[model samples]
Target: MSKLVEEFNDYRTRMNEVILSKNNLVMKRLWNLDTNTYEEGALDKKTKEMLGLVASMVLRCDDCIKYHLGKSYELGVTTEQMYEIFAVANIVGGTIVIPHTRRAAEYWEELQTNAQ
Candidate 1:
């Protein structure tokens, strides 16, 4: 895997372990909710992930963007669809989201490279 992708996954995993080890009920429940929310349902996992990517971009959360981007890629979202998602996010989020879009593109590239 690319260093960028590997590092992100490693750090996220380590932190999640630490956080979950605390045994905080609310945090655990919230995490569980997040997990369950992305399951195959009325909307389907792929569509939900696309929406997640859009919302993450608009919110300017790089981590969330990366997470959704990874999921979207795994779910077989095409490059064309990704660009469309970016366009929608840029439109809804305004110019402020441009920087995030750049980062997201970088992360997506890393994901592609890792896959190869």
Candidate 2:
């Protein structure tokens, strides 16, 4: 697995364990809902992942960016598609997204390289 994906899975596993152990019905339900929303839908999984990446960039959430970028790559989002996502992030987030966008771009390239 790509390092980012590995990290994300590790984090997800840990978080899921905590939520389940706590018996937090709301948290578990929210997680399930989030997962369902991201699955193939009217917008398609790839587009949703791309949009997730853009939102992650705008939110300056590295973990979110890593997760979404990995998903986007897994869904066969091309470098061109990634660049367009970055453009959207830039437009909506302005300069604040620069660092996040740069990190996401680097992670995206790394994922592509590992796949090759």
Candidate 3:
């Protein structure tokens, strides 16, 4: 795995464990809701993930962007498709989203490299 990818996964996992271990009902329910929302519904996982990626980019949440990018890649979203998604996000989010797009592109490259 790429160092960036590894680091992100590690940090996310560690923090999630710490958070969940606290046994907070609200947090647990929120986590469950997020997981269930992305299941193979009528939208399909790939489409949902792509939508998630766009929303994350528009919202300027790096962690959410990376999570959605990883899920999109795992769901077999093509690079070409991702570019279209990026374009939509940039169009909707305007100039402020460009920086997030740059990071997203970098993360996508790392994912592709790791796949090979």
Candidate 4:
């Protein structure tokens, strides 16, 4: 795996471990809600993940961005689509999104490189 993917997986693994072992009472419910939110319904899972990516960027949540980006890739969201989403994030989030966008772009490039 690329460094970006490795980092994302490591972060997710650690967070899951912590939540499952130490914070299950409240964290498990929150995690479950999050899991449920990504299910296909009125909006497809891919669209929901794209929206989640937008929300993550606007909220300046790196972990959330990584998770959503990973899901978007898993769901076959294209790099072009990601550029559009980043554009939306840039418009909605302004200068605050610069760093997050940079990080996301780097991860996307890493994913592409590894795929090739």
Q: Best lDDT goes to which candidate? A: 3
Q: Write the per-residue lDDT of candidate 4 for residues 5-94, one digit (tens) a residue.
A: 897899889878976988656788898898999999999999999999999999999988888888899899999999999999999999
Q: What's model 1's lDDT at 78? A: 86
Best-performing candidate as measured by TM-score: 3
Say which prediction, candidate 1 or candidate 4, comes out ahead on TM-score: 1
Clashes per candidate (backbone, < 3 Å): 0, 0, 0, 0
TM-score for all models, in order of appearance: 0.98, 0.88, 0.99, 0.93
Indicate the worst ten consecutive residues by lDDT in candidate 2.
Answer: 1-10
Residue-level lDDT of model 2, residues 1-116, one tens digit each, is 67766777798889879878897889889989989999887899988988888888888999888888878887888899789999999999999999988888788878877877
Error of 4 at 19 (Å): 1.8
Q: Which regions of candidate 1 fall more than 4 Å away from where they truly are?
A: none
lDDT of 3 by residue, 1-116 (tens): 99999999999999999999999999999999999999998899999999999999999999999999999999899999999999999999999999999999999999999999
Candidate 1: lDDT of 105?
92
- Pairs with steric clashes in candidate 1: none
Query: How would you order the candidates by TM-score, starting with the best?
Result: 3, 1, 4, 2
Show the lowest summed lDDT stretch of 10 residues, model 4. 18-27
